[model samples]
Structure formats: C-alpha cells, structure tokens
Target: MGAPFEIGYVFSFLPKLLETLGVTLLIVAGSLLTGIVAGFLVALPRMYKIPVLRTLSGLYLSFFRGTPILIQLFLFYYGLPELLKPLGFDLSRAPVLFFVILAYGLHTGAYAAEMIRASVEAVDRGQVEAAYASGMTSYRAFSRIVLPQALAIAVPVFSNLVIALLKDTSLAFTLGVMEMTGKAQTLGTLTQHFFETYIALALIYLVISFTLEKVLLAAEQRLKRHEAREEKAGRSFKLRRKGSYRAVLADIDAGKGGRL
Candidate 1:
C-alpha cells in the first residue's frame, strides 16, 4: 500500500520547493527575452513579405507552433547536439538548462511572432500614411506612430504568453533541470508523499500566477490609459450632442404649441 496521506507534509514541503522557484523564474525570464528578440526577427520577414525569408519564417513558425513543447525540448536537448556535430560546433556538453531555455524560447518565438505581426497590422494604415505625408521617413513613421499602438495592443497578449511560459516551465524538469517541479518530484519520491508534495507545488504555482496577473494587469491598464480616456471622452461628446438635439426638439414642439 502507498504511504498514508499526510496533510502536514504539504506545509513542510513549501520551503524546499520554494528554494527552486528562482530557477523556474530564471528559465521564464531567459526564455522570454530570447523569444522577444527571435520573434521580432522572425516577424520582420513576414511583415515586409521578404521572398525567401518569409517562406523560411513561415516554416519556422509552423514547425515550432505545430509541435508539442515537450518534444521540442527533447529535440533541442538531445537532437541538437547530434545535428551540430558535423559542423564542428559541439553542444553536447552544454548544460541542460541552456537547452531548456533555448527550446522554450524558440517555442515562445513562434507565438510571439504571430502576436507581434497581428498587433502591428491592427494599427491603422491611415495613420502611417499621414506620418509619411508629414515628412516622416519609413523608420520614423513606424517608430513614432505604428510601434506605440502595436505595443499597446501586444501588452495583454504578451502578459498571457508570459504566464503560459511560467506554467510551461514545469516541463523543463523532464530534461532533469532541478527547477521547482523537479525539486517537488524529488521530495515526493523521498517522502513518498506525492499527494501533499504536488499540492504544495500547485499552491506555489497558483500564487505566482496570481501575482503575475496582477502585475501584468496593472501594466496593461497603464499602457491603454490614453485609449481608455479617448473612448470615455468620445462617449461623453456623443451624449452631450444627443442631449442638445433632444433639447432643441423639445423647444420646437413648445413653440408649435404656443402658436397653436
């Protein structure tokens, strides 16, 4: 029979699991940074419709987004070294953590690429044309006009991506990286308290996810503050105009009554 359920073990496992939380965060942060840079590079080809590069970027996005992340991790951790051996660039001895970050980054890049492209396209074409007509160069117009709106649109999606990445980091333990999940596994095995250990782990993840949501929500609100204000002002203006029109109609009816 399995070990009896120990509610106390859940509390006991918290500190040990927390010790490895930094590693999980490290993986997320590293992967997020790498994904952003790679995603932008990948997105450019498609955005500009570069001939060969656009095709290549599409294949890249398809491959990464199509495959499961766990498989991608294995490919990077195991298959990459073998593929590189013929090129005289050895990666076999590289740390597992490196492979984990790389795989996660590439996986994240595929999603981020789509997010970035869509956000950029969602910006009004007229605004960009107006910028160009006003003596703005292509780079200047994009930087000054398109990029801000695109970033504002992308923030919410990026926040979601980050949260997903945080959760996905649990899979990194499959590669033997001693992140929080890995630590939990070890604790569970040694104590034979799988139930409590996982409960503790779940609690940790829930708290982290909650905190991230709050922070990212604040950031999203901050970025869209101007848009919110503009929308509010627009609504107010419409209401005022409607009220004035109603008042005018009421005055005309009263004048007709007086004449009658």
Candidate 2:
C-alpha cells in the first residue's frame, strides 16, 4: 500500500517553504528588472522601424521566443562561460544566481519586447501627431504622450508576464538555487513526505499569484478611472462649446428678425 497521508507534515513543512518564498521573489524581481530594460532596448528598433536594428531585433525575438526556457537557462548558465572563456571571463566563479537571473531575464525579455512593441504600436497615431503639432520633439512626444498610453495598454499584458515569470522562477532550482521549489524538494526528500511538501509549495505559490492578480487588477482599474475622467472632461468641453455656438446662432437670428 502507498504511504498513508500525514496531515501533520503539511503544517510542519509550511514554514520552510514560506522561508524560501523570498528567494523566489528575488529571482523574479531581478529577472523582471533586467528583462524590462532589455525588452525596452530590444523594442526600440522595431518601434522606430530602423532597418538593420529591426532585423537584428526580429532575430533576437525569434531565437529567444522560439526556444524553451530551460534550454535558454542551460545556454546562459553553461554556454556563456565557454564563449567568454577566450576573453578572460570566467562565469563559473560567479554566483549561480547571476546565471539564473540572466537566463530568466533573457527569456522574459523576448516576450516583453513583443509586448512593448505591440503596446507602442497600439497608441493612436492622432495623439502622436497632435503632440508633434504642438511643437513637441519626437522624444518628448513619445515620453509625454505615447509612453503613457502605451504603458496603460501594456499593463494587463505585463501583469500576465509577471505571473509567468513567478512560476518560471522555479527553474532556478536546477542551478542549485534553493528557491521555494528547491526548498520543497529538499523537505520532501528529507522527510519522505512528497505530497505534503509539494502541497505546501503549491499553496504558497497560489497565494502569492492571487495577491499579485488582485494588486494588478486594482492598478488596472485606477488607470481606467483616470482615462474615463479625461474622456468625460473632453466630452464636457465639447458640449459647452456646442452650447455656446448655439447661443451665438440664436443671437444672430434674433438680430436679423428684428431688422426684418
């Protein structure tokens, strides 16, 4: 018969798993920071339609997006050192966390580049033209007008990528990073309570993921509210202008009729 369920093991291992949750968060945070910066850089060429840069950016996306993340991690962790060896660089001495972060960052960056590109493209051209017509420089127009709108459009998609990155951080365990998944594995092996250990791990992940979703949803609603206010104000201004024009037309009619 299979080992009987030990309800006590779940509570016993919960703290250990929670302790490693911070490590998981660290991996996610590092990867996100690097990935976001890289993604923006990768997106620039595509957004501006630069000839050679766009071609290179497309290749970057194709390679990173097409490959599985695990393979990417291996490539970054193992392959980078080999290539850099001739340059007197030894990645083997560096902390595994560096490689883990690099791998996840590169992997996440590809998806982020596409998301950023799409978001930037989604911004209304009319708004951009209006900014330019108002004497805004290209950079100023993008920063003041296009970027804000693009960020709002990108947030929903970015939130999804954040969640995915959180889950993907589990792969860091392969590099001996004792993240939540790694800690859970250790607990499972030591106590021989696989199901209980994994259940605790799963719960921790679910709770964090749920919290992120709620926070992101709240931010999304706030952006929507701000947009709604701007739209309402625009409509109100238009209505007031229309009312003033009607009053002017009525005055003209009254003056003409009196003369008649």
Candidate 3:
C-alpha cells in the first residue's frame, strides 16, 4: 500500500524544514551574489575587448557553457583533491562548505559573464558614442550610459539563471554539503517518510522560487518604467515653472510695467 502523505508529519517537521530552507537560501543567494559580481568584472573587460582578458573570458564562457554543471561540480569536488595535492592542499581538510560555494560561484559566473557581455554589446553604439562625444571618459560612459541599459536587458535572463542556481543547490549534496536536499534525504531515510518528505520539500522549493520570481518581476517593472517616470516628472516640473512665470508676466503686463 502506498503510504498516505500525512499533514501531521509536515507540522512536526516545520522547524527543521525552516532551518533547511534558510540553508538553501544561503547557498543560492551567496553563490549568485558572488557569481554576478565576478561575472560583471569579467564581462566588463570582455565588453571593452581588453587585451588577453577578452579572449580568456570567451574561452572560459565557452568551456563552462559547453559542459554539464554536474560534471563541473564533480571536477571541483573530486578532481580538485588530486589536482591540489601537488600544492600540498588537502581537500578533505579544507572547508567543504567553502568548496561548494566556490564551485557554484565559478560555474554560474561563466554563464553570467557571457550573458552580461552579450547584453553590453546589445546596447546602442550611438548612445555610447554620444556619451563619449559629450566629453565622457570611457569609464564614465560605461558607468552612466552603458550599464543602466545593459542591466535592463539582462534582468530577465538573469532572473532565469537565479532560478537555475537555486535548483543547482541540490547538487551540493554530492560534495558533502548538508543543504536542503541533504537534510531532506537524511530525514527521509531516518523516518521512512519518502513520499511525505519529498512532497513537503517540493512545496518549499516552489514557494521560494515563486517568491523570488515575484520580487524580480517587481524590479523589472520599476526598471521598465524608469524612463517614463523621468519624462513625466520633467514635464510636470517645467509646466509648473512656466505657469508661475506666465502669471508673473501677465500681472506685470496688466500693470503696464508699474511696480506693484
């Protein structure tokens, strides 16, 4: 007989589930923040086509995008032990959590670098040239003119990658990192609650991903409305100022320029 999924088990496991939820968020957010920052730096250089860095970014992106993330994780977790032995570094002695974060960060960074580089290139060359023509330094042009628009374009794709990163946190179990999935697996085996355990875990993941997507969608809305806000505010301010000046001029004209 298929074991009935018990709501009571979920209620009992609530505290433990919440704790694991936090751990899942930690790994997801930590890796994404680190990866995006690193990717931005790499993408910036590649966008500028900097010497050697551009080619290196291209190669790095190609290699990571070309391979499965599972293989990448395995390489970092297993291969690193042997590879770093020559340098007197023992993987087993190192912080396993740190390696999990590092591997996730590097893997995500490669894809993000390529995405950002593409977004940067998609920005209008004329707009960038206009900034340069207006006496903007290359750095200033990028800061003020290029990044804002590139970021706007990249947000949707980046949102998808965030979801992917969250899902990928499951892969951490192989590296001995006790995250959400690890916790779930441990608890399931201990309690023999496979069906109930997975159902609850799935719900938790769904809730988290949904909440994150909502926040990202809200941010995207703000970004998309930015130009419209600026225009509306500018128009209103100009109209108010013009109306004030017109009233003053009309009063003076009505008095035939006499002091009043």
Winner by lDDT? 1
Per-residue lDDT of model 2, residues 1-260, tens digit only: 23567989889899988888788999999999999998998998998899999999999999999998988888888899999999998777999999999889988999999889877766778788999999999999999998887787778888999999999998888879999999988988887889998888888889898999899988877755766786677752211112344334532425446331
Look at candidate 2 and tell me the lDDT of residue 143: 92
Query: What value of lDDT does candidate 3 attain over all alpha carbons?
Result: 0.77
Model 1 CA deviation exceeding 4 Å by range: 236-260
Candidate 3 per-residue C-alpha lDDT over 185-206 given as tens digits, one digit per residue, 9 for 90 to 100: 7888888777777777777878
lDDT of 1: 0.88
Q: What's the ranking of the predictions by lDDT, best on top?
A: 1, 2, 3
Per-model TM-score versus the true fold: 0.88, 0.86, 0.80
All models: lDDT?
A: 0.88, 0.84, 0.77
Model 3 segments beyond 4 Å from truth?
A: 88-90, 228-260
* Weakest ten-residue segment in model 2 by summed lDDT: 236-245
Error of 1 at 107 (Å): 0.3
lDDT of 1 by residue, 118-203 (tens): 77876778778899999999999999999888888788788889999999999999999999999999998898899899999999
lDDT of 1 at 216: 83
RMSD of model 2 against the true structure: 11.6
Model 3 per-residue lDDT at 75? 82
